[model samples]
Target chain A: MTDIRADIHAQTGASEPGFGDYVTLLKPRVMSLVVFTALVGLLVAPVALHPIEALAAVIFIALGAGASGALNMWWDADIDQVMRRTARRPIPAGKVEPGEALGLGLALSGIAVIMLGLATNLLAAGLLAFTIFFYAVIYSMWLKRATPQNIVIGGAAGAFPPMIGWAAVTGSVGIEAWLMFALIFMWTPPHFWALALFMKEDYSNARVPMLTVTHGRRSTRRHILAYTVLLVPVALAAGFTSIGGPVYLAAALVMNALFLHGAWAIWRRDEARAEADGYRTEKQVFRLSLYYLFVHFSALLVEAALRGTGAYALVGIAG
Target chain B: MSTRTTPLRPTHELHKRRFSRNLGVGLTLVAFIALVFGLTIAKVQGGGTLQAYDHTFRPALLPQDD
Candidate 1:
């Protein structure tokens, strides 16, 4: 079916990108994060879905995430063309047309939401739909270019996967779900700000009003530290919830301590000093931030395992 | 002076490179389709896999006194 006309590149003055390029547009790495977090949500929820149903829910959630990624790429292709880091992305690189990405995103969004509903419940599906629109339309199209707080408000989109996962099983949200949401929501500013610290030039050149670009690296650093303080408490609190056990609590305590130390180091460094030090502190924090969510969720799984073996009793025994 | 010709050389090299690339693409595409299919089928068949945590901690496990 990949005939000449089906290519759609020659007539549009665009190049025919390979399959890999289209996959790249989906932001598989980000989707992986979504899948993991949503898995945690589903697992930690009060109810237990069937094994196959749980897997299907996570897959649909991931598809929703990928759909959001495609739409974000489509909308941001213009700005992406101007940013050095993003210039090589499929849509901006002319490997994939923006329209193709848009269509793929819309199709996946519908499929994911519908399938999630069929497999699970309306609440989970509705939440997934909201997450897609929040990321694609509200966050990417409107907030990203309009304000420095874009990531702050838009962080909700990334935070929704776990909630959606929880709802998939329990068919509702509770404090635990929101706690998971808070953990990611608070973590986002500092996580992306660390990248902004090093990639400020890219944002500036692209004319995107990132906090670092608009308010200066110093202000961004301050914000990172502040958010880190907020995140640590929220993340640690999640450890005390019904889903949490000794394993998760210990992990959260240690991980959050390390995260704070790293954030502090970033705040203390002068730009030139940081440059000379190769931004190692920020880079390390960024890497750890990636692991932070995964480890926390995995620790919850550990808690579940313990509960299974009758090793540890539920802490709250309520909620 | 240089009359030696390895008869299988060109075909062997072509096959090696082509096979690897084809294998890579084929594996990736299959994995993607399988993931989607597995999820869809799982959804249709029985809802979803129990989360590791869920299987470990069932609702029945709650204290009977409550």
Candidate 2:
């Protein structure tokens, strides 16, 4: 730990972070996903919101996601420096100080929660607060290092966006909201496990108990296949909900077929074969997983748009 | 006898630029907070009249009343 601190000090001696570095600290990619899912939740809700209120709700939810990202980076600075993929992140790369990251995160968290409550409702704001705390304190600080089930339970933090968005509009959670949450929650393990398979050494070096590090690659592969199988039902079931439509069902069928095929391909590959191919199948599955979630949500958005235009009325499935 | 030369100091212009940047950031944050507060108040008091502020900042897609 001392060596890590010394390494950080050496790298950051006189470095001055640019505005972009501060933005990087917020994990913009993760924030984008959060914002998109939350927006879908808000738009798909049965209730109506004024344009300004919807916009404000999305913005505050985004800020809360950013705050969680910053706090995660701050808490995981040590392991971050060890991981090859994360070594160049703001704090680890010495672009931003840990203290600055913490302060920014705390400030953003407070602002997002307060403003969300004012803009939407107390339920949404409260959920946003819990999401931040769960990600930062529970997942990042505790679960991440403690168990192989880290991503399993920690996935809840990422799963809350749509629920919060639903709450923003309806001031309560519903089955559809939980279904959206469930889709992401189920997707996280296989998605992360694929990355972990390829980046085994990083988790090993960081001593983080990612399933890959603890249970070995063979078990991780089985887990990936299992979770992907489990995820299919959730993903398919969502397409039958009020938010679901022909577009969503079509997309779900095609995407789930490809997703399952990819998972099965990984499940069949031995460690030696994976190593021989540089974990290509695992990496492909991981990439597909990203599109899988995005397309699912996008299909929901399309369903909502179709309903907006009375197109679903033709099919008589307009709820 | 000390023989090491001291490093050149940053120029006054650099200091001024830094100060100005800091001031800009500070002001931006303050303005943003004020905007959020003002909008929240207007939202609570005005009910569904968010369209009134549309001229100031219009959303790309407006929600329609059914």
Candidate 3:
């Protein structure tokens, strides 16, 4: 890492991240969630969008999410350098200047909002703009350094993709859209806190004061289990919505059971045993959490297909 | 000669220009959103009125039963 940093310094008199480096600045994993949730929103909304417009809107929203990621990297560069998990990120690696990242983020934000408005409706475009600002300014700048409850609040930034997607199609928000947002919002804490349980040292090293750092590992573990308990019902409830079906219900049921079991095991394990387990339990839980989300969303698309084929009826029972 | 620190004139002007530019852009964004909202309201209201008239007068417009 040091050699790479030295090479970067030798090549450029000043650290100016290149185009590819800028692309890396937009964390691709986070971008994937934005893309997936937004796709689900577009797919399940009652209002049908023309294919071209839908495609354009989704792409622009993804770009807007990416803009937020870049802004986050720019702002967090200092602390990111200290975090082992984030030290290799472009800005932290000294390949990019903070100002450059800020500029890129702002430019992309403008392009995305304008393009989405042109391709779809102004309502969706406005929502996308707000989402970008919410993440870049509200969550990244304000919430992160100020409080350990950062992830809980900042999680909303990640939840906006589906809302933006729904707005793109319907040009309005609804209960169903909020339900989807709620699912992701509730799921974020458990997913992140589990990782934090196993990697407490990283947070300590970075001085970021993550939940595990502020509280104890046991508290973080209990929080993970608690959130997982809450997550299961929400995940399953989504299955009964207008967009859900037998396939999704089944997937949610099985995935949530497995997730709950994993969280339970993590919470119950002895500290020495957990350390001896070599992050296996937490890693497995994290991986399962990834699949859990994808499967649920995929099931929604499957249900849509079934309805389109006249194989199944779309129905919403009274709540 | 005595060295004295004075505020940079160009820097002050740059900040002022930036401030004005941001203000203009922000206002433009707000106006655009308001216009769009107005248009959406108009479309929905027009659609509703049209639907109501169509439903109410459909029988009158049809050929009479013998």
By lDDT, the best candidate is: 2
Report the C-alpha displacement of residue A307, candidate 1, in angstroms.
1.2
**Per-residue lDDT of candidate 2, residues A144-261 (tens digit):** 9999999999999999999999999999998999999999999999999999999879999999998988988899999999999999999999888888878999999999999999
Per-model root-mean-square deviation over C-alphas: 8.1, 7.3, 10.9
TM-score of 3: 0.78
lDDT string for model 1 (B1-66, tens) is 565543434344334445654776799669767766766666445423333433443555454784
**A17-68, model 1: which lDDT tens digit per residue?**
5566767888999998999899988887777987867888898899999999
RMSD of 3: 10.9
RMSD of 1: 8.1
| Proportion of native contacts kept per candidate | 0.15, 0.03, 0.00
Identify the superior model by TM-score, candidate 1 or candidate 2.
2
On TM-score, the candidate that comes out on top is 2
Query: Among the candidates, what TM-score does chain A have in each?
Result: 0.93, 0.94, 0.92
Instruction: Give, for candidate 2 chain A, the lowest lDDT window spanning 10 residues.
Output: A1-10
Which residue runs of candidate 2 sit more than 4 Å off their true CA positions?
A: A1-13, B1-66
- DockQ (Cα-based) for each candidate: 0.10, 0.10, 0.03
After superposition, the stretches of candidate 3 with alpha carbons farther than 4 Å from their true spots are: A1-11, A14-16, A313-319, B1-66
lDDT, model 1: 0.85
